[model samples]
Target: MRRWLVLGALLVLVLLVLAPFALIVLNAVKTPQEYAGSGPLSWPSHVSLDGIRAFWTRVDFGRKLWNSAVISGAVAVLGVLFSLLNAYALGIGRIRGRHWVLAAFLLANLVPQEALIYPLYYLARQVDLYDTRLAIVIVFTAIQSAFGTFLLTGVLAEFPPELLDAAAIDGAGRLRTLVRVVAPVSRPTLGVLGTFFFVWTWNELFIPLIFLISNDRQTVPVALGVLQGDRMMDATATSASALLGIAPAVLFFLVFQRTLTRGVTAGALK
Candidate 1:
C-alpha cells in the first residue's frame, strides 16, 4: 500500500511538471485567431504552421539561437574544466584547508546572481566587456563553476584511492593520472555538470537582459521575452517561440539523460 501510494504521488508530480509543456506544444500549432478565440488549454481544431513561421520570419531567431549556443557551450565546457580541476585539488590532493575551500565554493553557490549582478556589471564595464557575448560567457562560466565544484568535489572525494595509488606506482604524475585515469572514470559526473551548465545558461534571461543592450546580441531567453511583449495579443506566436526556445535544452537533457542519472546516483552506494 505504501509503495502504491508513493508511485501514485510520483505520477501526479510528473503530470504537474509536464502539463505546461503539453499546453505549449498543443497551442503552438493553432492559428493566432483560433488561439485567442479558444482558451490556452483547448486543443486546436486544425493544425497550422503559421505561428512557427511567424516566429522565424518576424524575429532574428537564427542569430539569437547562435548567440545562445555560443554562450551556453562556452560556459558548459569552460565551467566543467575549471570545476574538475578545483574538485581534484580540493577533493583528492593533499592540500591544507581543503574543507574550508569546499565550504567557500558552496557559499559562492548560495550567493544569488541577482545580488552580484550590479558588481559584475560595473566590473565588466570597467574592463570594457559590457554588452558582449564574451562578458556573459565569462559570467556564466564563473557562476556555473561554483555549483559544479560543489557537486564534483563529492564525486572526486569518493573515488577509489587505489586507482590513484596504481597510477602513481606506474610513474604517472598528478596531471597524467587526472587526464588518463580520473577523467575516464568521471565521465558521467562531467556529463551531468556540462548538461546542467548548458541548460542553465541557455535559459538565463536577467543577466543577459542587463548586459546585452542590443536585440541582435541577446540570448534566446531574452529574445523570447521581447517576443512575448511584441506578440502579447498573439498567443500562438508566443507559444511557438517559447517552445522553440526550450527545444535545445530538452534535446540536450534527453541525450545525456542516462549519464545524468548515473552521476546523481553514484554517491548513493559509496
Candidate 2:
C-alpha cells in the first residue's frame, strides 16, 4: 500500500513537470487562433504546420539553430576541459593553497551572474572578442566552470589514492593517469557534467542577448525573443520557436539519460 501510494505521488509529480512541455509542443502544431481560443489542455482539432513554417522563415531559425549548437558545443567542451583541470588540481594535487582556492571559487559562484556580465562584456570588447562565438564560449565556460569544478572535485576526492600512487610508481605521468585511468572511472561524473553544460548553454539567454546584436549570429533564445515585438505576438509561432530551441537539449538528455541518472545518483551516494 505504501509503495502504491508513493508511485501515485510520483505519477502526479511527473504530470506536473510534463504538463507545460506537452502544452508547448502540442500548441506549436496548432493554428494561432486555435491556440489562443482553446485551453492548452484541449486536443487540437486540426494539425497545422504553418506556425513552424512561419517561424522558421521569419527568423532564419536554421541559422540560429546552427549558431546555438556551435556556441553550446564549444561551451560544453571548453567548460568540461577547464573544469576537469581545476578539479584534478584541487582533488589530487598537493598545492599550498587548495582550500583557499576552493573557498574562493565557491564564493565566486555565490556571486550573481548579473554582477559579472558588465565587466565581462567590457573585457571581451577590450580583448577584441565581442559579438564572436569565441566570446560567448568564453563567458559560458567561465560562468559554468566553478560549479562544474565543484562537482568534479568531489567525484575525484572519492577516488582511491592508491590507484594514482600505483600509476606514479609505474612511471605514468599526471596527464597519462588522468586520461587513461581517472577519466575512465569518472565516466559517471563526466556524463552528469556534460548533460549539465549542454542544457545550461543551450538555454542560455542573457549573455547572448547582451553580446550578439547581429541576427546572423544570434542564438535561438535571442531569435525567439525577436518574434515578440511591438506589432504582435504570434503565439503559435512563438511556441514553435521555443520547441525548436529546446529540441537539442532534450535530445541530448534522452540519449544520455541512463548515464546521467547513474552519475547523479552516484554523486548523491558520495
Candidate 3:
C-alpha cells in the first residue's frame, strides 16, 4: 500500500512538471489565429509548421543558436578545466588552509550575480570588452567555475590515498597523475559539471543582455527576449521560440543523463 501511494505521488509530480512543456509543444504547431481563439490547453485541430517557420525566419534563430553554442561550449570547457585544476590543488595536494579555500569557493558561488553586475559592467567598459561574446564567455566561465570547484572538490577529496601513493612511487609527477590518473577517474564528475555549465550559460539572459549589446552577439535567451513587445500577442510564435530556446539544453541533458546520475551517485557513495 505504501509503495502504491509513492508511485501515485510520483506520477502526479511528473504530470505537473511536464504540463507546461506539453502545452508549448501543442501550441507551437498551431496558427496564431487558431491559438488565440482556442484555450491554451486545447489541442490543435490541425498541425502545421507555419508558426515555427515564421519564428525561425524573423528571429534568425539559427544564428542565435550558433552564438549560444559557441559561448556556452567555451564556458563549459574552460570552467571544467579550471575547476579540475583548483580541485586537484585543494582536494588532493598538500596545501595549507585548504578547507578555507574550499569555503571561499562556496561563498563565491553564493554571491548573487545581480550584486556583481554593476562592477562587471564597469570593468567590461574599462577593458573594452563590452558588447562582445568574449565578455560573456569570460564572466560565465568564472561564475560557473566557482560552483564547479565546489562540486569537484568534494569528488576529488574522496580519492583513494593509496592510489596517489602508488602513483608517487611510480615516479608520476603531480601534473602527470592529474592528467593520466585523476582525470580518467573523474570523467563522470566532469560530465556533470560540463552539462550544468552548458545549460546555465545557454539559458542566461541578464548578463548577456547587459554585456552583449549587439544583436549578432546575443545568445538564444536574450534573442527570445527581444521578440517580446510591450503588447506582444503572437502566442504561437512566442511558444515556438521558447521551445527552440530550451531544446538544446533538453537534448544535452538527455544525452548525458546516465553520466550525470553516475556522477551524483558516485559522490554520495564516496
- For candidate 1, lDDT tens digit of each residue in 155-231? 78888999999999999999999999998889878988898899999999899989998878988999888767664
Please report, in order, the local distance difference test score of every candidate based on alpha carbons. Answer: 0.89, 0.84, 0.89
Clash number for candidate 2:
0
TM-score of each: 0.92, 0.93, 0.95
- Window of ten residues with lowest summed lDDT in model 2: 224-233
Scored by TM-score, the top model is 3
* TM-score preference between candidates 1 and 3, better one: 3
Cα distance off (Å), candidate 2, residue 189: 0.3
Note each model's CA RMSD in angstroms.
1.9, 1.9, 1.5
TM-score winner between candidates 2 and 3: 3
Give me the runs in candidate 3 sitting further than 4 Å from their true place: 230-233, 268-270
lDDT pick, better of 2 and 3:
3
Q: How many backbone clashes does candidate 1 have?
A: 0
Over 4 Å off, model 1 = 1-9, 230-233, 268-270
